[model samples]
Target: MWSGPPQPDEGLPTGLSAVSVPWKNLGPSKGHRESPGSLVENPASRKEAQGEEHSAAAPLDVSRLRSSSMEIREKGSEFLKEELYKAQKELKLKDEECERLCKVRAQLEQELEELTASLFQEAHKMVREANMKQAASEKQLKEAWGKIDMLQAEVTALKTLVITSTPASPNRELHPQLLSPTKAGPRKGHSRHKSTSSSLCPVVCPTAGHIPTPDKDGKELSALVRAAVEDNTLTIEPVASQTLPTVKVPTVECNNINTCALSGLARTCHHRIRLGDSESHYYISPSSRARITAVCNFFTYIRYIQQGLVRQDAEPMFWEIMRLRKGMSLAKLGFFPQEA
Candidate 1:
């Protein structure tokens, strides 16, 4: 019943294959075996073939996964680079801001330093001016104190004299005409003779009825009067002379004028002294008279100064005034008057 090849299971047992079965005759004829409907299969063998195909595909899948992992790593590297660039930019901005702030702070500090220096200079100038003014004021106060001390000494001397003088007498007041002095001039044989007790010694006579008897008080008064007149400390004229004899030298009161020529030892003789008879004994040489007159003139000048009659000026008269005053004071003490 079979054609070219025997049917593989034509007389096969129902439960088992023949014992002499050939491997080439294991299936039906080739034409039937190749048919989809007649193809023989077992469950276990199909599973085994599918497992082999899966095993062969696993290496390709693993290769594809590895390639995807490499791509992911590359993208992560790009992200990291971008982040690093942003950080660098922020750091640069921060550094720039810090530098700018430092510069601004330095400028402000410099300005403050300048302002402080200016203020200190101004303060120093003010202090110097104030010190100068204070020093000037102190100098003025010292000068005023010196003047006050000198005046006080003068006052004390006057008080001492007034307390020690004598009491009055009546006979000395009654014959006061004998003490009267006549006019002084040049005349031959002018027969009036007048002498003063005060002329014998420098004595300041008492007022009318104020003469004392010869006693301790009287002697003390005479001594004090002599001392005062010799020292030129007292300005009182004796009661014996009514008018003081005037010298011929022209004198001008020192007003506000500061400079004037003062003759030291020059002399000019009067006409009365130039024409003289042999018996005319009233004569004083011009040089001798000038020496006496210079003393008188210097004392008068100092009195005027003490009375505040003259105002000092900025001119060169201060040296002259000081010299003359010192000379006059020394002359009153019976010492030689120095050259002015």
Candidate 2:
């Protein structure tokens, strides 16, 4: 065959010439895989490959990560510390609350004890007062019963005396000398006999004075003496005088003074009776009569006290009346007109 020229051997060593092969003759064939060492022949390429490998194998920035982790741990520790502080503060507050409650409970218990003791003392005092009142009431009841017994005995004795007494002449038929007038008699118009008669009247006699016997018939005198002795209304005693012989004169008994005074007051206050009329009428106005009746009632109360009918002490009725008159002016008491 005719070659174009003498071609150098290209497939030989660095000094060998290139040998041209026909491109159509090169068939399809598997290419051989090259090793990394064989592929990286240039210094620059080797450096590049080593750089990539280092980049892939290199670990993360350990210093930065360690710093971040430390920061996170510090933050967590701070949070924990804050929580602990809050818990301690809450515990302290709870302790203080508990102490306050304890103090309040102790104070309440003390007050309750004091109240209980005071209530107990008050109950005891009430019981004692009730006992005293009961004792006093019982004593009063006994005294009242004793008084009733005494009154009954006195009534029985008086009834017995009345049954034994002799009947006397009519009270009206008794001489004016024997009967006493409530008011003062005329001073100038009396003869000696009239004066003697007035003196002999028992009602006119002073409390300390002796009553002379009336110069009446012996039968009448004996009857009067007998009546007086039996009635216990008057006491007759014989007194020897320098001028006169032993004479029996009538004197008011001390025990009968209250009865005599009451009778005298009643007589003085008696209603006016017309001679032929059965009805009696007071001369004074009703108001004045009421006042008189009040006075009589007051006297009656005093008499009851003196007679031991009531428990209260007996004040002198006349003294009280005088005190009332002195303390209360007529105008103030409405007795006289204020203008007057």
Candidate 3:
């Protein structure tokens, strides 16, 4: 009665399906025993078939899920790269700012070093100048002390001479150097404004009594007077004349000087002076003061004058101007006219 191929059953036997079942017995009428739809389909057999289909679809679902996870991983990696790039850029900018700050600090340090070095150099210069000034001041003080010591010695010598010397004449002429000395001959380059002006002018020294300008004879006379004013010796000695009347001078004592030849020689220091002829006649022994002082007497001066030492004619005038003559008394020595 059925014409089409028979319907498939909901379940099929193992190793046999509904399609294998002959729907029509076209080969032979005896081979057809049942139709495809007429086959028995149990509930257990249908469950087994459905379970197999579900198992077959499981692998496809897993494959699809794995592909979706791969896509998600790729997208996340791109976002991570962008975040890293932004962080690195911020770091680079911070590094540049740090480098700028370091450069500024180094420049400031260099400038500070230079300023400190300059300050130290200036302080060193000031210290050096201060030391130089201190040294110069010390040198000046030493020279002044030396001068003071020399003046002290001169006072002792003046006291010695004042004890025995005779009074000077009231009619004594003026000192040659007191009233403006002779003008020196002009030098070849006189207009050059040289420092020799001190040499030309008279150097009136109040302390050393009378220090005249440098003349032909003033140099030697100054040296002699300086020795007397120095209180060191009696350079110009009077002659001892036996033919003329003898004036006895008592043996002298110098408490100021007690060393060397002047030590025990006070007894032998007595001498009979020839009045009015008080020229240098004999040489006396020098004391322990100056070595050349003994030989630098009037005799030596006369010899030097003969050998072209010019006129020191102001010697007597210099002696007169000095106040040493005030204490001198010729009447004390029993000379020509005795004083009242």
Instruction: State which candidate has the highest TM-score.
Output: 1
Error of 1 at 37 (Å): 16
- Compute each candidate's TM-score over C-alphas: 0.42, 0.32, 0.39
Clash count of each predicted structure: 1, 5, 6
Candidate 3 backbone collisions, by pair: 154-230, 157-231, 166-328, 166-329, 167-328, 167-329
lDDT tens string, model 3, 1-340? 4345444445543333332223333342586776555445433554565456545655766676788889999889988999999999999999999999999999999999999999999999999999999999997887676566545534533433333344221110222221121222334322312443343334322222443332325345446445543433443332222221111112321221111122222222112111122232112123322232322233233333443333356775455334233322322232332112
Total backbone collisions, model 3: 6
lDDT of 3: 0.41
Per-residue lDDT tens digits of candidate 2, residues 1-340?
A: 2224334335434532343323222233468555576545545654454455444433334455677889999999999999999999999999999999999999999999999999999999999999999999999998888688668745743442233133222232233322333222345332333435433435333454544333354355335434433333322111111211111223322221111111122122212111112121112222233333344334434445456655543456556656545433432343632110
For model 2, state the Cα shift of residue 47 in Å. 9.7
lDDT score at residue 87, model 3, on the 0-100 scale: 95
The model with the greatest lDDT is 2
TM-score of 3: 0.39
| Residue 271 in model 1: lDDT | 10
Candidate 1 lDDT over 1-340, as tens digits, reads 1124223345433433223222223455656545553344444544454455545555756676788889998899989999999999999999999999999999999999999999999999999999999998887886676567557645643432232133222132222211121232354433322343333212112322222222124244335434543455432211111122221111221111111011111122221111111111111223333333455456555654665544476353577677777765655454663333
Looking at model 1, residue 221 earns an lDDT score of 37
Q: In model 1, what are the clashing residue pairs, if there are any?
A: 168-210
